[model samples]
Target: MRALIAVATAATLAVASPLLAATLGDDGLHKTDWMRDTFKDLREDLAEANAEGKRLVIFFEQRGCVYCTKMHEEVFPEPVLSDYIEENYFVVQMNLHGDTEVTDLDGEALSEKAAARKWGILFTPTILFLPEEVPEGQSVSQAAVSVMPGAFALGTTLDMFTWVNEKRYELDGDEDFQRYHARMIQERDNGKTD
Candidate 1:
């Protein structure tokens, strides 16, 4: 019994250690050292994107959301996807339940949690694609080009990334995402001969 207890205790410590090291917010999100940024800073990065003629992609997630956890653990860690995101988009990770204050590009100070609320971000792992400047006096609905919710496989995620990168949405329409994504998979399986 004593040996069993000791083993259980060790296992518990091993599991809890990493979580304890992570900074957890109200929404149960563990803010790790990597790929963590506030919404305000994300907006600033968006502005930089505008200046540099790039696109802005923001990922809103909460702690304890299974899908979000899967995304961070599985998809984001994939080398191809990670490398593409790091290079092409001004990626920002925001905690939905964090209370930290952030300053927007428009010089407005608001809590990160408040910003998530204002954006109507209730889902875990919601990815928002935005243009350089969120058109003047327009709401998020108008400014956002795409909003993808939930966790996706690396292949589908990469296809979405490629579609956005190539501005396929502009010509192909929103529903085309799935179709194009399917084709991408098929081509990859066929060794991308065409």
Candidate 2:
């Protein structure tokens, strides 16, 4: 009976452990099952995301980033946030200072580092949420519907993800992200979390 109980406990822990811990890759970035490994081609990635019924999201991160670590350890591990991201976004991670080749939506080929520079990204953990139908002749950066810079608390981060996923940017109104996030916070506190 003791051995059987021990085996059951071990099985439970094995299933529960990932929810409590986020894995780090050799490249010093958080490794999640939802993040895609692709050829770093934005056009192809966008098409793939559209076909999957998901939005394209580009994540920029650097090695040894404390904010990235915080996001992976705290915000992203939350079940609600993680499940939402996995369901709505096709995420592609780019190293802020690495030499991986990338093809932009406008056919500009550059290294990952160069692409980050071209997009004016100056921080770690920058997330670019893209529209489904990008206008021709524009780069991915130019076509991005929203850019989330720096780490945020779970609520704000989740709200931003939810906003971009729901195409709230296209809605005709003056409720920008700040107002939308505030409304979401109010709603969540009122037991309306979604």
Candidate 3:
């Protein structure tokens, strides 16, 4: 009976462990099942996302990023956020200091590091939310509808994604992200919003 109980306990703990905890790639970045391995072409990624009825999201991360680790271990592992992201976004990961080639929407080909420099990305876990269509001659930096630059808790993270997915930024600037986030928080606290 003691051996059986020990086995059961081990199985339960294994099953309950955070799935993202053990998915670190050789690059030392956390990998998720939803992260798509792509050619790093913004235009093609957007097209693919559109075809899948998903949004295009660019994630900038680097080795030894503590905030990235926090996000992977805590925020993203939450089932609600993970399920929403997996279902609605085509996420492309970019190493902030890597040499992987990337093609910008404005037809600029550059290494990942250069692209980060060009995009003015200075932090790990900078998430770019791209619009469905990019204007001609516009770079990803210029065309991105929203950019989340740091780790956030579940409520804020979900609200950010939800706001972007709903295209609230296009509403004549009536409700900016801060306002939208505030309202959403209020509603959630009141148990009146999703």
Off by over 4 Å in 1: 1-43, 102-109, 172-175, 191-194
Which is the winner by TM-score between candidate 1 and candidate 3?
3
Candidates by TM-score, descending order: 2, 3, 1
**How many residue pairs collide in each prediction?**
2, 0, 0
Q: For each candidate, what is the lDDT?
A: 0.70, 0.91, 0.91
> What is the C-alpha lDDT profile of model 1 across 65-141, one tens digit per residue?
88877777667767677778777776666777777676554555677778777777887788888766665555443
Q: Which sections of candidate 2 miss by over 4 Å?
A: 1-3, 11-18, 191-194
Q: State in Å the error of residue 147, model 3.
A: 0.6
Candidate closest to the true structure, highest TM-score:
2
- Please provide, for model 3 over 1-194, each residue's C-alpha lDDT reduced to its tens digit, 9 standing for 90 to 100: 99999999999998997565527899988899889999998889999999999999999999999999999888898888899999999999999999999999999999999999999999998999999999999999999999999999888899999999999988895689888888887888694543
* lDDT-best of 1 and 2: 2
* Residue 64, candidate 1: C-alpha displacement in angstroms: 1.9
Model 1 — TM-score against the truth? 0.71
Q: What's the residue-level lDDT of 84 in candidate 2?
A: 95
Native-to-model Cα distance after best TM-score fit, residue 146 in candidate 1, in Å? 0.8
Task: Name the weakest run of 10 consecutive residues (lDDT summed) in model 2.
Answer: 185-194
Candidate 3: which stretches are off by over 4 Å? Answer: 1-11, 14-22, 191-194
